[model samples]
Target: MRTAYSVETVRAAERALMARLPEGALMQRAAAGLAAACADLLGRVYGSRVVLLVGSGDNGGDALYAGARLARRGAGVTAVLLAPGRAHASGLDALRRAGGRVTGADDAEGPIARADLVMDGIVGIGGKGGLRPDAERLAGLADRSRAAVVAVDLPSGVEADTGEVRGAAVRADLTVTFGTYKPGLLVDPAREYAGIVRLVDIGLELPGEAELEALQHADVAQLLPSPAAESDKYRRGVVGIAAGSARYPGAAVLAVSGALRGGAGAVRYVGPAGDAVIARFPETLVSDAGPAGAGRVQAWVVGPGAGDDAATVAEVLAADVPVLLDADGLRLAERDAVRGRTAPTLMTPHAGEAAALLGVRREEVEGARLAAARELAAAYRATVLLKGSTTLVADDGGGAVRVNATGTPWLATAGSGDVLSGLAGSLLAAGLAARDAGSAAAHLHGLAGRFAADGAPAGAHDVAALIPEAWRDVYH
Candidate 1:
């Protein structure tokens, strides 16, 4: 798992580590890493023109020291000091000794525009909000230039902890972050500005608990269900799917397609489109019966293309088993009914559905995805799987939110969420907690989407069909 820590946690860890090390040792370690990464980015350092946008803190010092190293290696380095008086006196002196030229902002733009690489040390993790006017102007110039811009710690002007971009901010081709991964580097909005991120280990021992986590293959392998020799179909666990309407029978077929491949013992489907489901998957036990009349199931998946079937959603929610809600279920189910359930509930909502529930605009939810996921989980007192370019799973218990690090852009097909809903519901039936089920389901779904699409456009059926391959790829 790739875990991210909050700024407060990072600062505490940094202070402890610094106290143990000799004076200036930590900064030198950071500077060495920064210079190495810059040299790689500037393939031909001997002839490359490197420009450093220096600011007023240790961030500026890191840049100045790195500039000195490049100058010694024969790169023509220029330091454009944003705060000349407040700059690190030792670092400035070191740069001058190594033959690096110090120029004011008046002569900076010309060098920046012609440079091959631009290093942004204008702000660090401690900085907040957007860039100041001068910094914003420099950011604009960097954007206009053809140089490959590299940001220090994080891109300037983005909220370090929340991934929020307010006012003007610097966009970087790459970002070299120190010590630990900040929440901003992993989440969206701020994630968008940080083009490609590289973490530099400065040897700070952080907290064991992380604010967020992204599951990898090994973690998912441990969570998958396996049948014992004595286990029968019923013992493995049954997933009940209540989806589709007379208007859209394909939704029922697609949901079943996903559930069948979710390592469940069997699938019990009940809805208006029962015939269509059984026709597609002869293995499915089908009935037009409501959720109450449906046979025993460990978990229930409700409301994909279900239209106005509010009673079905309510009936499924009232059951004493885990329930996965999606599409129309998010709209039709009463808030009281969802909140009142004793059993666990997992809601898979797109930005628009999430917005409707939160009574905010879709843009607001998309802009602050991490905050929106947490707010929704707390509000409904359930686990929320907010699906988008980056899918996040958050539980009401306030544990680490899981971020999915897979999938292709080609996954925005119709009925895609329906497939994901069924897969997650099946995992719930197999006896995983709400958090584990949602996170594991997202991991599998994303991998399946990649295999199904590859490069060409794919339909929901294509993705659902590849679930077995995704499962094998995980374990082996």
Candidate 2:
């Protein structure tokens, strides 16, 4: 897993590491890594024009020191000091000694425009709200500049803890974060500003568990289910899906579509639309009885166009298995009943449903998706997946929340969410934790959506049919 700690955690870790090392050692390490990355971007260190947008804190110190390193390597470096008196004394001295020129904010615009690269050091962990007036102007100039921008720590003006951009934030072509990943670097809004992220280890030992994480290929591969030679159908785990109705048989088909392709031994369908589900997926075991009489299952997928049948939803929820709730299930759910469940519960809600659950406006949920997901997880005491452009999954226990970056906007098609619900439920049956199952399923669903569409518009069934290809790609 690619772990992301809050800014406070990073600062505390940095302090502990700093106490052990010599003064300015951490800054030098950060600068060295920054300079090296810039050199790589420039293709050659010699004669490269580099501009540093220096702020008042350690972030500016990192840029100034990096500027000194670049100057010594035969690059033309200029530091645009936003706060001249408050600049890091040692870092500025180092830059001057290395033949780097320092220019005031008044002289920055022209230099920034002509530079080959710009280093953004306007804010760091200490930063609160958006850019100050002068910094915003400089950032606007950088935006118009032909230069490639590299942000130190994180793109300035983004909330380091929440990934929310309070005001104007620098859009960096690349961000080189020190020690570990920050929440802003992994979550959206801020993630959108940070084009690509690179982590530079400063030898800080992180403590305990992370608050957030981004899943990598290896991490997902490890979490994925792989059948063993000795395993039987029962040993591989079974998933039961309670979805669709006479009015919406497509929901059942779509849900079974995902469950059938998932790495489960068998998929049991129990709903009014069993015939339709079986027609689409002959591999599924269709049952006319409700979820209560569906026999044994490791996990249950509830909702997905079951309409307003409170009794059906309650039966599924009462099952002694990990449950994934979605669609109309989210609407008809008794909040306390879900919270009282013995088994792990995962709630997948779109912005509208999430808004209803939280008693807030849909716009609020959309505006700050990370906050919404976390709030839902805390409120429902369940793993919550807020589906959107940047899908967020949060564990109820305040552990690592994940934001899936693999999906395409084309996934907005009808009944797509039903497929995701079934897929996640299947993974839950396969013995993955709720958070892992939800995130992994979201990732797979997204890849399948993209693969099915392939840059064109695709129907929900197309996305469902592409699950096997997506599963193969993940394993391969």
Candidate 3:
């Protein structure tokens, strides 16, 4: 699993490490790594023109030292000091000795436009909100430049603790982060600003529990279910999908399609669209009975295109097994009912749906996805899988919120979320915890979406159809 720490935790680790290391040794290590990464990006650094946006913090020191390394190797490096008097004194001296030129922000535009590379050290994790006007102007200049922009630690002006980008921020082609991954680098809004992230190990020992975690292939593979020789269909587990209405029968078909491939022994579908589901997957155990009368299922997925089926959603919520609430269910299901459930409940909501549940603006939820996810999870005392550009799974008793980035932008099509609900519900039936089920399902769902949409538009069914392919790729 890929883990990310909060800025406060990372700062503590950095301070501890600095105390043990020789004076300036830790910074030197960081600068060396930064220099190497820059060299790799430039290919041949000797004749390149590099522009550094130096601010008042250690981030500026890192850029200056790295610039000095490039200058000594014959590159024409220029440092545009945003805070001239407050800049790292030793770092400035090193750059000057190594033949780097110094300029103020007033002269930065010309060099930025002509430079082969621009390094942004304008603000570090300590800085909050957005860039000051001067730094924002330099960021705009770098953005307009043809040069490859490299951000030191993180893209300046984004919240490191949360993935919120409040105002003007630097957009880097590559971000060379020190010590550990910040939550901002892994989550969205801010993630889009950090194009490609490269971690440079500055050796700061951190806590075991991170603020966020993204499951890698190996971690996901370990969580995937495998059948034993003695195991039968019922023994493995069955997932019930109570979804669809007369108007939107395809929602039922799509949800069942995903459930069948979701490691569940079988799918027991009980809804108005039973006929539509049977036509697509005859293997599904379709029933006319409501969720209450449906044969035993280990878990249930409720409310995808369910229209106004509040009774079915309520019935599923009362089940003893784990339940996944989505789509129309998110609207029809009462907060008290969901919270009163003895079994685990997982709520999957897009920004709009989540905004409705929280009684906030959709834009508010979208802007602060991490906070929204956590708040929703805590509100219902359930696990919440907030779907978006970066899907996050957060549990009521939070530790590390899981983030999934394997999805394509093409996955934004209709019914995509319904497929996710079924997949996650199946995992819940297969005996994974609410958090694990949500995380693993998101991982698989995203990969499937990628395979289905290989640079082309793909329907929700196309994504569901490729789940096996995604599973195989992750397994092997």
How many residue pairs clash per model? Answer: 0, 0, 0
Q: Summarize candidate 3's per-residue lDDT along 1-476 as a digit string, tens digits.
A: 88899888998998899899998999899999999999999999989999999999999999999999999999999999998999999999999999999999999999999999999998999878989999999999999989999999999999999989999999999999998999999998899999899999988899779999999999999998889999899988999999999999999989998899899899999988998899889999999988888899999999999999899999999999999999999999999999998899999999999999999999999989999999999999999999998999999998899999999999999999989999999999999999999999999999999999999999999999999999999968
Supply the TM-score for candidate 2: 0.95
lDDT measured at residue 88 in model 3 versus the true structure, 0 to 100: 98
* Candidate 2: regions farther than 4 A off: none
Evaluate model 1: give its lDDT: 0.90
- Model 2: lDDT of residue 424: 92
Instruction: Pick out the ten consecutive residues of candidate 1 with the lowest summed lDDT.
Output: 285-294
Instruction: Tell me the tens digit of each residue's lDDT in model 1 across 141-260.
Output: 999999999998899888788888877999999999898778888878888888888899999899768988888999999998988999888888899999999998888888888899
Highest TM-score model number: 3
- Indicate the residue-level lDDT of 143 in model 2: 88
Task: Give the alpha-carbon lDDT of every model.
Answer: 0.90, 0.89, 0.94
When superposed on Cα atoms, how far off is each prediction in RMSD? 1.6, 1.9, 0.7
Task: List TM-score per model, in order.
Answer: 0.96, 0.95, 0.99
Candidate 3 error regions (>4 Å): none
lDDT of candidate 2 vs native?
0.89
Query: Residue by residue across 2-30, what tens digits does model 2's lDDT show?
Result: 88887778889989989999999999999
Question: Which is superior by TM-score, 1 or 3?
Answer: 3
lDDT for 160 in candidate 2 is 82
What TM-score does prediction 1 earn?
Answer: 0.96
Candidate order (lDDT): 3, 1, 2
